[model samples]
Target: MYETLASVDWARLQFAVTALYHFLFVPLTLGLSFIVAIMETLYVRSGDEKWKRITRFWMTLFAINFAIGVATGIIMEFEFGTNWSNYSWFVGDIFGAPLAVEGILAFFMESTFFAVMFFGWDKVGKGFHLLSTWLVAVGSNLSALWILVANGWMQYPTGMAFNPDLFRYEMASFWDVVLSPVAVAKFLHTTGAGYVTSALFVMGISAWFLLKKRDVVLAKRSMVVAASFGLIVSLYVVLSGDESAHQVAQKQPAKLAAMEGIYEGEKRAGIVGFGLLRPDKQIGDKTSPFYLDITIPYALSLLGYHDINAFVPGIDDLVYGNAEKGIRPAQERLDSGKIAVGALADYKAARKSGDAATATAALDTFNAHVGDFGYGYLEKPEQIIPPVTPLFYSFHMMAGLGFWFLLLFTVTLYLLMVNDITRHTLWLRAALLSWPLGFVASELGWVVAEVGRQPWAVQDMLPVHIAMTDISGSSVMITVFAFAAIFTLLLIAEVRIMLKQIKIGIEGGH
Candidate 1:
């Protein structure tokens, strides 16, 4: 049992299960928070009974989703301490600050304002109620900002220096972490995606109401909000996603290679649009051909480098040095990492023997190579590459969904301007059917972001296998199933309650 508990695979599965479950509800909470705020703002401005009822109805749904989100989110955070103690220890100095600040600043702000937003309608002044709702929206976004900052730092580590003696990373600048390009891009792209999902969700539900010919005025107004807001944000999501791609191409080329299923190095790389991605080579097969993929000519180069002709290094280019391309091979990093580890050992030994000069020299050598230290733990340079098939499909799924969402919302918005939205049965049906696709797109985006950065828990610094707390397989497996069961039960309850509320309509929902 003890031996099995130390298995890395089980530990990863445990965390993945919990994280994925938590994420299912987060985007809805993020998007719905703002939508409800906007609805309330409309009620405050117009003082219309129908608008007030609409605000309360949507707020009820938002509260249900937010409640579940809070539950699942807390579980994932706790896992950071329980299952990923090593990861916590290594980056805690730098990573802990943002998470701590998120709780101290954003979490409290949201929870406090959320109570006012949810419960203080008639009890509070209209102006105060509107302010509270706006604060809830702002607070929720700020929470997302800080969380993404932490995640972005993991992807593209900055504002930190390694402390080899302490065996951890230390924060050099909090502002740098908060304003990291990757973090900012991710936050915009992700929150924009949240808005897109919310729009789709509202449109779909409103479409259903239109189809049933019940609450036509309320549904039409909801559709108007959903279409106009969804279209704008879907466009922003694509634009921000492009910036995120550029960040990845620069900082994590191995991930970009996997995303395109590009095995061979090339000067003009294409982002594969579609085609089967299969295992072309097992580990250690240098000359193996990669999967047959349909390439979108110059798209990858244009998106990744903002230059249509820019060289995009492939998996082989990264694994084995491409001198023509000036790509430093992974093996070089692996070798440097070993030197860093050895120097770290020497530093410890010298310090133990009271040789100050020797310790200082060894520390310098370790620091020089410490950026590649995660490579030391890898048995093969080939392991630096993430799983290609999963990354490729996940990338396409997300990109494809983004385009679908854009088209759908654009058409919906246009139709909204031209004719009566409730009368168009086909369009209404299409919108009604699109609600699930939004969730699918949201999940696939996360799958691409997280799974595409595989092997490394912190890119080029710490691999996930090295980050686990060394717990047993059974222990991890038990938690995996436990979370699965818990989330499943909660989801059932939420759906049931939400359905009942939706059935009750505007007035009774409150």
Candidate 2:
């Protein structure tokens, strides 16, 4: 038991470290590509050499981020084989398809057009060059879309059926997987956040220029573009976030309960406006667990269900059950799961002994309750629950930062429109200082999403500890430290290069 626990923790830590590092570069790529496209478009429309220089400068930064992001991304693919081989095989049929399409279609196109957007500035026609830049932007987002689709499937696990014969899940409908509501919502929210990150980045640097009294014309123009763009998309991100929350309520109630820090079932649960989630709390352990909490009445009910009167299940309700809320006791699922697991063992034994008829009969019974297969491994309902501490705080941090971004962009947009940001030194300095908030908000949002769904690698279908490959704990621990060290070195190199380029200023582009 100790060895198993240690292995799971080490493997999870390794993957989490890799994922967090990779994401740092992704949002910038998402937002900067379009910003670069917009700049290139302005250059093409006005035939202005200054606009051309501005476009080239941002594009150079975009290229650097893109290259580093890609390098870091490759390790995740390798991690799947090395650390998560069991999971890879279990749902390879369903999960592998989106990844395959992303590599063949989105990634190739992004790389191809990216070269043209860079070196072909002089070699290609002006029209073709502009087209290439737009293509790169589209390709970058398409890559995001497919990756989200794969991730969304893991969250929801729809459009697939378990295959007893193959002992794996197979795709039931490709389009269903591709067009999942969860996937669509995630794509919008994620890309929207990326755009927010880019806008903040541009606005911050432009604000820095204003403070330094350098390149007034270019800096003001950049600020206007970023402020306008950020305003519209920040609104979209919040809306999409609400939609995402609604979906989570429907599909992942335990995660929602954890995020909201709900301990007991209620008809009209309040949304926690501010709270310090106490460490000692657990499902069924506390009726009111918070150390400090401020709530907006019925807000959680309305936000999660779109119905003010709807009942929201708490952690205890999710673990045990609430008959009034239409929730079945988890023990019932566990009971059925044991029978199904036994049937699978019987089938395997019969097959080994060359009894075709017995194998077929046992297989039929196993398939009947295959949906509860993961439950069979658990001894009790508490085994289904994830760690609530990270989920609770991460959600708040993400939400708080999101609102701050909206206010920052809205105020900055107004200032840019009035063309009087130079008059407000404090506001300009705040903008320059607040560049990292977007990255913080973005990472926290992911932490809430991924950590909230803990225990399960594929929701209720597969637990991550069970799904991870059979590897020694020490080996995983060794690899975890190695990856952390290497990624830290690369990140330092990237930050230094970016700072040097930015320090050189707008003149560096020419």
Which 10 successive residues of model 2 have the least lDDT summed? 280-289
The backbone clash count of each candidate, in order, is 4, 0
Global fold similarity of model 2 (TM-score): 0.97
Superposed model 1: Cα runs more than 4 Å off? 1-6, 281-292, 507-509
Model 2, range 178-256, lDDT digits (tens) per residue? 9998899889999999999999999998899899888777888888878888888999999999999999999889899
For candidate 2, the per-residue lDDT at 461 reads 87
lDDT of each: 0.84, 0.87
TM-score of each: 0.96, 0.97
- Clashing residue pairs, backbone N/CA/C < 3 A, model 1: 4-473, 5-471, 5-472, 5-473
Check candidate 2 and list the clashing pairs.
Answer: none
lDDT of 1 by residue, 1-510 (tens): 334225678777777777777777888888888888888888888988888889888889998888867856777679889888899999999888888888876668988888888789789999999999988888888888888999999999999988776889999999999999999998998888888899899999988888998887888888888888888889899899999999999988988988887777676677778767556565335554444666788888899999988999888878988988888888898999999889999999998999999999999998888778889988888989888878778888888888988998998888888867667799889999998788888888888788877888888889888788877777788878888898888889888988888888765648
